[model samples]
Target: MKRVFNKFLIQPKIVLSIFLLTSLIVLISALLEYNQSKKEINKLMENQSHTLLDAILISSNDAIKSYNLIKSEINQRLLNNAIFIKYLYENNLLTNSKLTQIAKENELFRINVFSKNGSRLFSSHPLSKFEQTFQNKSKEILKEIFNGEVDTLQIGIKESQLSNSYRYVVAVAAKDRSAIVINIDANKLVELRKESGFGPLLKKFTQNKNIIYLIFQNENGIIAASGNFKDLDDLNSSSFLQKSFNEEKFYSRIFETDSISVFESVNALIINNSKLGIIRLGLSTEPLDQIAQKIINRTIIQSIFLLVFGVITFSFLFIRQNYDSLSKKFRSIETYFKNIFDNVSDSIILFSNKLNIEAVNNSALELFNSKDKYELELNFNSFFVDLIKIDFTILEKEISINDQTKFLLISKTIFNDEAISNKFIFVIKDITHQKIIEKQNIRNQQLSALSDLSSSVAHEIRNPLNAIATITQQIGKDFTVNENENEFKQLTKIVYKEVKRINSIIESFLKFARPLPINTESFSLKEFFMQLKLQYQNIFNEKNILFNIQLNKDTQVKWDKFQIKQVFINLIENSIDAVNNNGTISVFAHEIDNKIEIKFSDTGKGIQEDILDKIFNIYFTTKNNGNGLGLSIVQKIINEHNGLINVTSKINNGTTFTLILPKVVEVKNV
Candidate 1:
């Protein structure tokens, strides 16, 4: 009882796993607490920093609004002046002096009127100021209004070419599609922008004790910076800063210098629809560092405790595992055998004493070409229905399925398993291919011996046949013909014919005795079959036979065309002889496993099972007129091509000959 209980107990690995998992949880809990506390502190700092950045951004927004407001007021003033000038021109009270007077009254820098064609009809400045140009200043400046693309255009704030000052230019369309242009000195507005920009914001944030520096900088240099700002890495040299600007994302990290460390936040700055540069705000990290030092001291103590506990616990598990190693090794060995049982190439089926299938390996399933155990069991029982009669010592047998025979080596043994009193194991190997090779070797030996024997026999027979033919010819020519002349001539003719027939037989024997050279070439079986059908159409028609060539797919094979043709011709001639009127002879071909399978089936008086095995033997014939060499030669040719021939027949049903030929003929003894 104790031994059985021990066998059923939990394994050492699982127990160790539980203990290790508990330890891991404790360690992870400690680390997570520390991380959560750190994250809380970081969260607080992030909230504060975010508030500060938002305030800076709000200030930038306010500045943008202020700058836009100032420009809007200037644009309105210039537009009103241009409208007044247009009113005068429409009233027919407009002249060069009128334009000049309007410019002076409005304190405008320049004013000009252009026709739809950009010809200057009026100008507030003297024409001498524009004389060096075409009929007007470059029309591109007011091209929108001149080309009637827009009624008004504010050509705002361009530096003056003649003076170092700037100009605020505007244009409006008047009567006849002429354009009225106006401008003013833009220096005062530019000064207003300078007073309300990012500079003040940068200076304002630098007042905080935490802020080490704050600046707005671009690729060239700093656009605006606080008075106490410190320079560190530049955009060209700092990929971190470049990433922040390029991705337009907010980023912050610790910035270390020889003197101090700071948490710096960076992001691109944009105001008034213009990307000015990046805003960099560096805050002192003294507070975060002081807290981090305290957390580190506590973490170090906790980590040391975990390391000591892990070492002690691991030592305990190590000793426990030593005691458990024997059982683990046994289990692993069992598993190894199980894997081998399933994966080995020989099919293995385990049966109970009652012959019920208890287990089958992967190879067993594959051997029977089944998907599951149920189907496999059924097939096994059906295929081996004579299993009880099988001699316990018989190691090899042949089984045919689908008119195809396979040689299997079956090994059966009985063993006493722990759970089952008697278990039968059948290990099977499909040795059909090996059997074919062995048979081929034997056939080659037989053919070689026969070739030699036939050579000797042919020499013996031909000498007598030649002498008899000469003597008979001399008798028919030299003997005197009396009243029995006709009878005498007929007898000589019979002698001559017998001699000729014997010679023909000897010639065929000699031909079979010699090696037939193969001329191999690639050809399409589909085309070859089609040609046969066409060439034999008249014969098939006369016999009223339905000759059908059914090809699964077009297959190209490299073979000796002449020899392969003889093989087919022999089969076809037999089919023609066997079939009666209105019978069907069909040729079928498909590719399988790189081999060409050709089937010749005929609806005819089928071969008897007893005689089927002897059909390919030399001089074996069922027909009276046949010399019986056709099928023997056919088998020889097929064997030479490294092919197999099988025949299936049922009396009065049909006979089908299946040929398994290699796509490429192989050189061999046969």
Candidate 2:
């Protein structure tokens, strides 16, 4: 019997018949079981959700009722008290109990008493005296109460994770001018009714079929009293809460691992105009598994009973059959080709030039610097810069790298009018270091050419400038003094003044052409500033402008003192030129965060916004008789020392010029 059954299992026709029959039975069983399980889960979830909605309605009604009663009690006491009544008519102190009594009765926190005349007479809580009552939104609601529009207004305080003291305010005003406010804890009802069955429910479902169940409240949609879901941190505190007050229903559909969660939302109407809350319940696949298990157990028992009869009927017919050897050979060939394609060192992306990756290798990930094949789909256009040797418009046929000619070979074999495989093989090689070196060489050459041109031109201009200055001085001395000669003297003075301007321009050219050589050594900035103060003391006194220097005593820098001094001198002169007679020029030097900063600021007319960008440009000026090369030269000197300069100015306010130089270690001259 065993041999007969073995032969029947090995036979092709008998095996095919058995497999098809088993598949058909399983499919029908699974479908019926799934539908029944789903229905049961949905019913259980909906019942629980409705219960949560009922809780919200009850809570809201309770809060509203509590608010109205508190307001009534406060008004009754105010109306009865002679002093309070008189105080409402006139200004006087009523007992603090007038506010405290209502606060205590309703389990309130604070009570504020506002007079009908808009004056805040007393408050149960000690608050800021100057707090603007009318400026706040709550005050508008309070105003309506004072006008006898509402018996009491109930207001819920917001939730803040940082604070535990939740609050609600109740306001009341009678025909009398006096008003009373009572505060209550807003979170009290929510805390009292939070159901804790959600955790166990989620665990049971997850164990059964890896599904999650969540519950939501109408008052707080995602505040599932019991569930494994994360908090509804996405809900806006004010607007989301207000949505419950406005909308009747909303739903959400979400997918989780091995399950789908359909959120069915409905208002929990406990009574007319009263809400308990919203409940969101989840149905999962756990019930489906239980039903399926039962079905499988039943099917197995039935299959065993039929196996005896079936084995006898089919056994003799299948005993003489032979197996095919071709199936094994084909499977082996398929696996061998697959292994070669997957293990190649370079990515063997054999696409039809339509650029779909048909075959990819394990090494393709490393070669393309990616972890997933999807990362490569964005095409060369996205990540080409990181891998390719050059950037040229894609449709260009041939590309050259470092003047080396490389042909982009496309396959000539045709499949329909397209190239055979329509495949183009292009390889990328790294040239980053070589490219960087080439750029540096080009920049150096350009700078060298500019320096040579500046030097030759400066020397040529200086010789002519000297001759012109000497002639102007000689011509001035040739004139004499008298009443008639006074007019001629003034004319020569004008010529000398203009000639002096030309000499200033030539001096700027010399400064730029021959930069001051740095004499780097340790220098005390504090001591340097003290010397500068002494030198400029008379100038400050004459102008009546305070000249102040603030230097850090501990600060020292290894720099060319003369060159840096020249830079400071130009900046200080510019500051002086900006300031009025009584204005101040402040110079500050300090070591800040490992950098040495020197700031020169003046309280004078600042640079205009339209011209600030031009201030650093060569040979640009805003001042009359100004050469404009001072700041340009200052920037050049700072750059040579590996420093940066910045200026901040507000027209009519003042201007500040800051020079930041990298701090250097001073070598001990032992």
Q: What's the lDDT for all of these models?
A: 0.80, 0.57
Highest-TM-score candidate = 1
For candidate 1, the TM-score is 0.61
Tell me the lDDT of model 1 at 521: 85
Judged by lDDT, which candidate is best? 1
What is the per-residue lDDT of model 1 for residues 575-651, given as tens digits with 9 covering 90 to 100? 98889678999998999999988889999999998998778777789999998788888878888787887777878
Model 1: C-alpha RMSD to truth?
10.3
Error of 1 at 658 (Å): 4.5
Stretches of model 1 off by over 4 angstroms after superposition: 1-117, 120-230, 235-324, 382-391, 481-483, 524-556, 572-606, 623-626, 648-662, 666-670
TM-score of each model, in listed order: 0.61, 0.28
Candidate 2 runs further than 4 Å off: 1-452, 458-508, 665-670
Residue-level lDDT of model 2, residues 18-117, one tens digit each, is 7567556655655665566566655655565456444544454564565556545544443344233344434454456755664566455665667666
lDDT of 2 at 571: 75
